[model samples]
Target: MVSPERHAALQQAWARLLDGYRVTAAAAYPVFDLLASAYSAPDRHYHNLEHLAEMFRVAARLTAITDDPAPVQLAIWFHDAVYDPRAADNEERSAELAATLLGPLGVPRDALDRVGRLIRATAHLTDDRPPPDRDTMILLDADLAILGAAPERYARYAGAIRAEYAWVPEAEYRAGRAAVLKRFLARPRLFWTDLAHQEGDVPARANLTAELAGLRGGEPAA
Candidate 1:
């Protein structure tokens, strides 16, 4: 569970974002509650409120790049709000959930559209979609910032991810998880933004290589 101060900070961030669009406190509390409950579910390990807090910390570094950070911030909030390890459409559904809930709260249409698109981009799928714009790249970078966290923190992240997939057998989980890590390693660049690249790429590659070795050599996961 999060500390009272941490919870209040998260709520305050949400309130500040919505207030720019003229959303009142009364109308905003319910949506915040919904997100809190969703992220706090027992099944979530890596994709929980802690991850949101981590992303928020990363977002703090690069706010100046975007003309309007509201939609980018919105995408960060809802990107994994619907995560289910077994589901293939988590990003799609999360985007829809953002639209459905925020539409009624009066986020502008263009902003809502950009938020939806930003959330979907987090999938990192290799479809033929056009390249992401700058703000979308910022959202994507923040979403993936955990990859380059300190070695100890990355180990905890790996362990938490393993915990989330505990339903699968150990062998199956290792194979699947290894494949995902390898895919990241295979990418031309793990992070898109210059600051993110500088901050995370080398460490992320090292983390992935080490984790892959652990998985392949029968070392304990995380």
Candidate 2:
């Protein structure tokens, strides 16, 4: 559960973003409640309200790069709002949820579409995924900022993710995780933005490499 202070701060951030888009407080509260419920769902481990809070903290450092930062903020709130480790269409489903929820709250169709695309971009499936626009890149970078976290925090993030997928068999999880790590390592740049690269690339790479080695060495899964 998020602390009262953290929850208040998140509420303020949500209000600020909504006010920027001309959404009224009356409309925003119910929407915030819906989002809070989604992120606080029992099955969520790493992709919870805490992760959203962390992304907001990261987003604050680099808001200037985006053409319009508000939609990116909205995308951050909804990107993993529907996360289910066993589901293949989590991103799409999350995007649709954003559209369904945000459309009537006075968010424009263009903004909704942008948010959907930004959320979908978090899939990290392949190297050939669509090249991100400035705002999309900002949202994507914030979503991945955990990889660049301090060592202890990064380990916690790794463990949380493992917990989320605890249903998978140990060997199968290790193989899948190794493949994901290899894909990140193979990327010419793990983070597209200079700020993100400087802030997270080295530590993220080190974390990935160490975790990959552990997987290969038969270390028990978290």
Best by lDDT: 1
What is the per-residue lDDT of model 2 for residues 169-211, given as tens digits with 9 covering 90 to 100?
A: 8889999999988888878777767899887889899988888
Error of 1 at 211 (Å): 0.5
Q: Give the TM-score of candidate 1.
A: 0.96
What are the clashing pairs of model 1? Answer: none
Clash numbers, per candidate? 0, 0
lDDT by candidate, in order shown: 0.89, 0.85
In terms of lDDT, model 2 sits at 0.85
Task: Summarize candidate 1's per-residue lDDT along 93-144 as a digit string, tens digits.
Answer: 9999999999999988888899999899989885233345878778878888
Evaluate residue 40 in candidate 2 and report its C-alpha lDDT on the 0 to 100 scale. Answer: 88
Model 2: per-residue Cα lDDT at residue 49? 92
